[model samples]
Target: MSNELYTVIPDGSVTTPRGFRAGGLHCGLKKTGRNDLGAVVSDVPAAAAGVYTTNVFQAAPLHVTRESIGKEGKLQVMIVNSGNANACTGEQGMEDARSMRDAAARAFGVAPHLVGVTSTGVIGELLPMDKVLSGIERLPAAVSGTREGSEEFCQAILTTDLVKKEACVSLTVDGIEVHIAGAAKGSGMIHPNMATMLGFITTDAAIDAEALQSLLREATEVSFNMITVDGDTSTNDMVVAMANGLAGNEPLHPGHADWPRFAQAFVYICRELAKSIARDGEGATKLIEVQVEGAVSDEAARVIAKTVIGSSLVKSAAFGADANWGRIIAAIGRAGQPVNPDTVDIRIGEIVTLQQSRPVPFDEEQATEYLKGDTVEIHIHLHQGDGRATAWGCDLTYEYVRINAAYRT
Candidate 1:
């Protein structure tokens, strides 16, 4: 893609540049007549890195891509479809995912293993091969670097997303300019262990497969891994990245002098993408940042923070802006970690809700007023150790229930 932002541009065609071409087309898998199939093809071989769901009931695409990533870190194309998650379909499901890749490989004239596939939406049905294959056949013709094509690509991968999600960042490394652009789809089922959402990031920077994989994993840990929507991981979760070395910079290596600068940019892009997913969470009207400090360990802090964020009671309370400090304390107590309740403290925004083990006197009206904003912060101090961690989540609301209730219909 070009250094210019494409898909999300307000008044332009969704065209990308020469190094990348994307397309989204109607495949009939979705009843809404929205584009349900998309493809992203790199003009040349690119270093690829991916992280898949940790769920045991993995999707066919997850299994296939896992093997491919193990064998070769370079990829040329990705094929994705929405409205029919090829999961729990037995042996035939595996074939369907492979067929999707094989068809894309044929269209792009690349090896089947070099093509990555991802699917989302309704989990138990066989993929409609007629529609999927027909869509794959049209990929060559649909290939375009235009802004309109990029929008189509974003729309095709969406399932229940109310708004299309995208982020872009540019950086200069070694006097060379590089651009990173990404698109993601997630409104529900978004507790990512590896990557609970479907997101793709493309960059023209030159980096080897091994370095790309390392950088991607590091970035994902602090970005996608720290967010939750409903605490439910998906079977088809994936985050794929491609670096086509089109930026004309020197290959990046971990120990190299320029590695730090490149790594920073990589993490910045991943963080932006992760935040976009949280902001666009299904039926979410607010975003919450849960920050934990002074835990037994960084890992322990993360567990505690995620536990608090995942609590239905906590989420509902946050949605209601009830200033329920007891629920927050209760969540921390049940986090399965060694901690002294007497040493625990909690705060909302800048208002201390609980200090040490007792409630702190504060104006309920003031706290409620703070919660009315689109962004809220919850802080916890364990006073037990120096470790700290932060996680992102959204409040629970009736709209969330309504969206998922009729999702498949």
Candidate 2:
């Protein structure tokens, strides 16, 4: 959609922004021979901000990445590998993550501190440095500042994700078209802990490091932090963002006249990517959207919405196309959020199954037809206040258990 504010561009990724180049290749880390290694580099150092998983046992690469961002708030390249999480290998894992950073710096001709590294899959295993370093060396040659290169990078980062997740939008900044885009990879072990998964976003707008960080944090609170998959947080969740001054726009700040426009576009990209991750969750057959409104407060609404979406019973009901509204009501009550028990309303799709906290007659055939779609909506109105929030998740299916049961296989 194009308008005076922002326009959505299809098939966009990190490389859609000016000065960024990216690609990936199979590096033997994955037995399937699919691409498992990828890198993204900016022609010049970019303003950087990163949000990491809140799991107590953090992954090794997260430390190096956090240090890189904290030290200079700038990044030129990011080295990423799938198939090995580089977590719980103790000191050696930290060392390997650092070595990956250095190897990538050498490959991209950037300082070590300017590189950020991340990994996923098979935690508790050390990275195969020989293969990873070799991939790094090949990464520079494979990476191009083209859309195809962006798609390659996208494919390289996936683990159990069934489909690629990418979003892009362009807006006029200082009369110049500035692009903001993002891609993410997540399926299992996903729950909102600051950021629920691994995501990379790039923009061509000239924004201060502090301003960009502020926007990222604010946007993530309502976007990535509102999604859930399996209700388990990962040890390596991170969302890193880079902004290069290639768009030739004046420096942007909190009070900048066009800051809201840029912020909205950035958040839209993040939200779309979040929804895609939820839709593509392991063994997920349908995306579920939970909307909670008329709560006592926005925070209360958020907690209720997330609880409803994260409920296994609710997810199972959605998967089976069952109009069992009791599970949702139970989730809301146990969410610890203040709610008027006598004034609650719940609906599945267009069928209002609960009115005034009581059961309402609904057609089972219509509910089954609605839930059969690829996406489902569960709406709740507390009739308490104007507070509102929305969270996303996927229906729990038998295939989910099967996938995880043999995950290591």
Worst 10 residues of 2 by lDDT: 188-197
Instruction: Encode model 1's per-residue lDDT on 1-409: one tens digit a residue.
Output: 3332222322322123238878889979988799999988888878899987888999998888766666678887888899999999999999999898888889889988789999998898999998899999997787677767778899998887878776665666567776667778887898858544788888888888888888888888878888889988988899998888888888878876677866776676677667777767788889888999999898899899888987889889888988998888889999998789788889999999888888889999999999888988999999999889888888999999999898777
lDDT of each: 0.82, 0.91
Best by lDDT: 2
RMSD value for candidate 2: 1.0
Candidate with top TM-score is 2
lDDT tens per residue, model 2, 92-204: 99999999999898888989999999998988888889999888889999899998898889889989888889999999988898999998999888887643368999998
Off by over 4 Å in 1: 1-18, 194-196
